[model samples]
Every structure is written in C-alpha cells, then in structure tokens.
Target: MSTPRHTLAQLCAAVTAAPVLLVAPAAVAAPQAPPPSTVIGGERLGLPGVQVDPLAGAPALPTDLTGESWIVSDATSGDVLASYNPHARLPPASTLKILFADTVLPKFDRNAVHRVADEEIQNIGAGSSLVGIKENLDYRVEDLWRGVFLSSGNDAVHVLSHMNGGIQPTVDEMQSKADALQARDTTVVSPDGYDRDGQLSSAYDLSLFARSGLRNADFRMYCATREAMFPGAVDKNTGQRSSFGIANTDRLLGKYPGLIGVKNGTTTNAGSTFVGAAERDGRTLLVTVMHPASYQRVYDETAELLDWGFASAGKVRPVGRLVEEKQAGGEQPSGQAGGTAGAPPPHPAGAPAGPVAGSAGDDGLGPVGWSAVLVGALVGAGAVVVLRRRTANRAGRLWK
Candidate 1:
C-alpha cells in the first residue's frame, strides 16, 4: 500500500489559492498598535494550513446583490459560511446601536427612570430618526431601549448615552468594547450611528456586534419586537398624557420565516445596512449586509444569503474561522487559532500535520496560505482532512 504524502511547498501553494478556516488560540496578547488599515483584505482573511471543502453542490452565492460588503455565519458556532468584502469599512447608520446596547444595557437597571434633559437630546443632527422624546419627561430605561430599537431613534441613543455618562464617554466605551470583541474594523464616533467623520464599521464587525449583543435578553427582545406602545409624555403646559406606537425598522422580522430580532440602518452615506438572524431546526444563522443601493435590497440580499447558508450548512466547507473573543488578562492558549478552545494535542512525527500560517510580513508571501480543492478520494471515503502548522514568526499576526 502506498502512503499519502504532502509537502510544505505543495500545501503552501494550495492554501494561497483559496480561503482556509482557522481555529483561534484560547488567549492572545494585547495589541501594541491598531492595524494600519481597517479593511480585511483577502490575503489576511484565511488561516494557513487549513483546507476547506468547496461549495460545489450548494446553492450559489447571490450575484445581483448591491451591498458593498456582506457576511453570513453560524450564530452558535461562529462559523463564517459566506462573505463578500466582509471587512470593507463603511458607514453603519443606525445598526451601530447594537454596539451601544451591548455596552450600556448591562450598566443600568431596567426599571430605573431617568428624566430627559434638554442638553442630553441636543446636537441630534437634522433629518435624523427620533422617537419624540421630550425634555423634562421621565422614562424608564426599558422604554428608552424600545424607542431605540423600534424606531431607530437617535434621540433615544443620545439620552441613554447621557445616562451612562456622556456622549463622548459612551462612544469611547463602545469603541473599547468593539476592540475587546476583536472587531477591529469598527470605529465608533457616534453612538446613534449617524454620519460623522471616522464613524465606520464593516459587515464582519456588525455581525460580531449583533452576535455578542444577542446574548443579552433585553437586546434580543428589543430587536425582535415588531411593535410596541411607547411611554406617554405629559404635556408640560396642557397636563395631557399621550403615548404612541413604534414599529421595528428591521423589515425582516415577521416577514422572513424563522427570522428573529437584529437591527437595520439607512442614511445618505450608508444607504441601507442590515443585520439579520434566523433559526431553523435548532440552528441559527446570522447575516449582515451593508451599503445596499436601496432599502429593499438589504433584506433581499440578506434573505438570499440566509437561504444559501441554511441549505449549505453541512454541505459547504468553511473558508475561514470567525475570530473568537480574546480571554481576560491577555493570555491565549498556545498552538490554536481563534475557534479552537484549548491547546491542541501533539501529533506523531511524519504524520499529515499541516503548519498554521501567521500574518503576512514585508514579503508578499507570509509563513502560510490556504486553498480549497476537490479531494475526490477523501470525499468518497467520507474523510475530512485538517492540516496543522506552527511557525515562530508572530509579527503582523492576522488577528490582533
């Protein structure tokens, strides 16, 4: 019997040609500096030494989509199923509220009441969305969240930011939360996601924020809610109390089967950006689409991606692993990538072990690259092969 043989050069060439899924180590060191660019290029998207199966028999990716960047992944497993320009930084519009909710929702008591101040609602740009918050009106924290989620109200976001501390401090904390989540592509200059200089996030980062926020019961309920009767404000002069209804901006909810709450945004610069999640047969899938040409296109493209992902779940192989959250104290377990939980067991000598590649350096070719190829024999034999590699060079590591 002939033994299967694979060489470093052969594996390197193959990995360089296609996307490779990576399992992240348990711990990672704190970054010394931010990445030079926010865009996650194709070269850095894949993990070296890992080979994924091609989506040969699955539904084809959407072609007529107008979004500038998009991504679909398994919500539970954090597996990136498909993406296009996943890391291209662009205006996020109101979807940035997901991050805001993640950062501040836990800080305040849901039943706590805060009186709206004129200064807290000041500086909301003209033509921005609002929930009709009035000065001197006391509102429960839960009601404010409903306003923010149901109406995409900038007013609610500003008021909440003020409660947390101030607008600037809330923005800084949100940015820090993004960094801790390993969502390096996000830069938060506005809590409400209104257009501002240097306020941007990528499809990948938006998806990350949504997934993280979903862990909170309040965030999930707010986004999933279709309609709610908001708290009534008492008329300062007339002494009359009035309440109004608000509907979720996310069109996918109730419209798409198995669709749950997420969020949506639109603006002159951002066009339409949406994050959607759906569950089927115990599996949940999340999709993020940004900068669609039209409001309807965001939903359409997201639905298409979700349909493809559900159908392709077991059939299609992963091109890249979603980077996991860095553990506390800045210590990562050695020899594993983002998705892998713990240190990997050592392999025997001369085994078919593949080396994991680090980020690219000055040279165009880094220590490793990944590719997907049809392995007829392996597929026919019902065998999946994982190539493991380890290198000493850590400079410019892909996941900082």
Candidate 2:
C-alpha cells in the first residue's frame, strides 16, 4: 500500500503557534540560545566544560576542543567515555537528518520509483543545500537516500517526507522516534533539518541517532558511501537519461583512518555540526560536535576526540551510558555493537552468574518477579483453606 502525502508547510503549521514565527528566524539574527538541557545521560554530563575520569596515563583531551556541545561513546556498550556540554540544545542543521533517516528509512524499497511533483519541492527554506532535484524527474528510493546522505539535499528529503505520507506526519513520527530513542533533548520542527525557530537537538541526542542508525544495514551502506550517481533531467525529444555525480559533504569520509560516514551540517544559526562513527579492533566509537569555533574546527576537533577516545581504552572510566534500557523496536541493538554474532549481552562486571543465580528462579526481573510469586503462593494457600471449610459446612461436618 502507498502512503498518503502532505506538504512540508503543513507540519510546521500543525506545530507552529503562528505563521509570523517563521518570518523572524530567517530575517534576523538567531536569538540567544535557551538554557542548557537538564542532562539526560549521567551525573557528570550535566557539569560544564570537559568531562573525563582521571586515569593514570590516559591520553589528554584535545586542548583545542571548542564545541558548545559534544559527546564520545562506545557504540556497543552504550557507555559515554566523555563529554562537554553534551545536553546543550542548539540548532542541528543537517545533522538532524540522521534522525529523519532513522524515522523514515525503513518504509520503502530502494528500487521503487517515484516521479517528482511540483508540490513535493515546494517551500525548501532559503539558502538550503541542494542535490539538483528537478520537478518531473523520476528517482529511485536508493538514489534519494544517497542525496540525503551524500549531498545533504533538502529537496530529496522533502520528496521522501511526502512519500512517507506528508511533512506534518513525518515530523510527528520523527519526534516519536526521538522519544523512542530516549533523546530527550530533541525537538523536530523541520524534517529537512533547516534552521527554524523551534527545531533543535543536542550532542547527546545526535550521537544516539547516529548509533541507532548504524544498526540498519542500508543506513550503514548509504552513510559509508562517498559518492553515487543521481539522475539528470530526461531529454524530452530523445527520451534518454544522463546521470550526475554527487559526493559526500563530510570532510573526514576519506581522510580519517577507520572512520565511518555519519553526517555534517552548517547553517546560519547552527554554525557547524557533525556526528562521526568509527570502528577499530571490534569497538565502534560515536562522536558528535555541535557549534564549533569555526567551520573547519568541527571536523578537526571531531578527529581529535576520536583519537583520544580510541587511545583512552582502559585508561578512562565511563561516566554514563547513552541508554539505560532498550525499548525493543526500530533497529533494536544486539547489546554489543561488536559482539560475537547473536551473543547475549555481557553480564555486568562482578555480578553473580552460573547455575546458582539461575536456581533462584529468576525471570530476568530479578527480585520483583520473586516477590510477586511469593504473594501469589500465600494467596493460594488461603484460598485452599477457605474452600475446605465451605465444603465441610455444606456436607454438615466441620474440621479445622
């Protein structure tokens, strides 16, 4: 079945207090950012400046680090190695596309085709990036995804957003997806991630989005790809098609060793933002940098963070975890990002295991399940006594 479609403006209209709200963000300077987020990941994460456990001989944190918000975490264990203003809400620019992809990527087959409509491309914000999507041109779902990952194309995003039923519903679903990931700091106002009055995300939330998105095979493939061909306008007379090349906007895609493609974003209000993932020695590290000192620093600082995170190894203790519990849907993690295929989650360090713990009659809910069973057993005993007394009375005999 095909999804119904709605215009991108409809989403903001559904959420926005007034149409006048949109006019000011673009015409004037970005307003002063709101207060820092109330720290969702851990106790130490809420503190300002750099955060790292003091471990003997650990590599020093990058001295030049200047992002307003950032986090580095182990993708498998979900442990946050370190952070700086991790919960600070700021404009995400295109990095929010990661969440958009997380919400909408699984809905359609890659080979499915759609012809662009005049309305689909309507209302992409001013100064928005483009991959040259033209009305009346047909594109495969795979190519559209490439446009999103590689070119950071707003046009491509809108078309897909429409195909998913409409802009309003897509935004709603994206918000729902964010909540599902426990990304408490995100507010989705625009699906293409263009700057808007209420649209925002945190470094922590962005990292979560990247880690969750990495679990999908297709998402991994698209983000890792450096280049792909996009369809050109059809020649009306010849009835032929030509293709144009599009390369990934991420600067570290080819330069950084062991780096996996994630995402990059820049906008007037957001400055520069990025979320990067890399795998080394069966461990994957996720890094997110938002509102760096300059356009270049976002990538440079990200590389430094990645280098420090890899080298820290046993030297630094984890401050907290990205998610404390799994919700069991939409790219559910297999516990370890690099676990042996289908291996169960590793037991907590020093926690009891083996036959003894199992013999305690654990239903995985631990003491809570046992408590319920104990209450049930006592209630059953009482019911048996009451039934015996009632039968004796009815038969004209009594015994206790």
Q: Estimate each model's TM-score.
A: 0.72, 0.73
Per-residue C-alpha lDDT of model 1 across residues 114-212, encoded as one tens digit per residue: 999999899998899998898988898989999999998999999999998899999999988887777767899999999999899988888888889
Worst 10 residues of 1 by lDDT: 381-390
Q: Which candidate number would show the highest lDDT if scored against the true structure?
A: 2
Best by TM-score: 2
- The pairs that clash in candidate 2 are 4-165, 5-165, 6-166, 76-337
Model 2: per-residue Cα lDDT over 7-41, one tens digit each: 54554343355434322223222112222223456
- lDDT by candidate, in order shown: 0.73, 0.79
Go through the candidates in order and give the clash count of each.
20, 4
How many clashes in candidate 2? 4
